[model samples]
Target: MDSQTGTHDDNMKPATKKSLRGFAAMDPQRQREIASLGGRAAHQSGHAHEFTSEEARAAGKKRHARAQATGESPRA
Candidate 1:
């Protein structure tokens, strides 16, 4: 039973066991190494974009304006 929600434990569905496949199966260190390799490859191939401070500020301002107009929260 959930003390806060006042729900009976038996009414809840039992948790199922799931096998972690592909990237999800990897350990954190292995994942970081794989991601690092991809990032390095992208930069070496000139496919990666590094934003300037001014550009980042402009993008943030634009995002804020769009969010304000749409009555949605701005992303951090």
Candidate 2:
């Protein structure tokens, strides 16, 4: 059960604009370990989406637009 929502935990709710919990709260080594597991799973499952040059450009544009709209400078 999710304490915040008081319901069975699922990802229906969007993440908060800011978070200091879960993997974000974990130490760097722990975060890397978790991220590595995710990458490995994606490879094993053959469901990872790879961006081509054009797709990457479009995705970058979308990300930058969101950041600018939020008054945030995009991180490198």
Candidate 3:
């Protein structure tokens, strides 16, 4: 992060930044497109997990139970 501006540093040299960029500088649509492509590639490469229907349902039920018990968002 930039100290004076209190913002992420986006003015990095090309050599330093060739592999990554300040995500805040990316347009939302472009970010989504890139993220979607990465997700598809991960699944194609067998590197990403896909939940079974039963697993998803169980997870959702657990989340709801947690929320009910805590009175806060399950995600929190």
Alpha-carbon TM-score of each model against the true structure: 0.75, 0.42, 0.57
When 1 and 3 are scored with TM-score, the better candidate is: 1
Regions of candidate 2 where Cα sits further than 4 Å from its true position: 1-25, 60-76
lDDT of each: 0.94, 0.86, 0.87
What ranges in model 1 sit over 4 Å off? Answer: 1-16
Candidate 2 per-residue lDDT, tens place, 1-76, comes to 6889888757576657876897678999999998999999998999888889999899889999999999898774
Residue 11, model 2, lDDT: 56
lDDT of 2: 0.86
Give a tens-digit lDDT track for model 1, residues 18-49. Answer: 99999999999999999999999999999999
Clashing residue pairs found in predicted model 1 = none
* Best first by TM-score, ranked: 1, 3, 2
True lDDT of residue 67, candidate 3: 99
For residues 1-76, write the lDDT of model 3, one tens digit per residue: 6779877767764455555568767999989999999999999999999899999999999999989998998778
The reply for model 3, stretches above 4 Å from the true place, is 1-21, 73-76
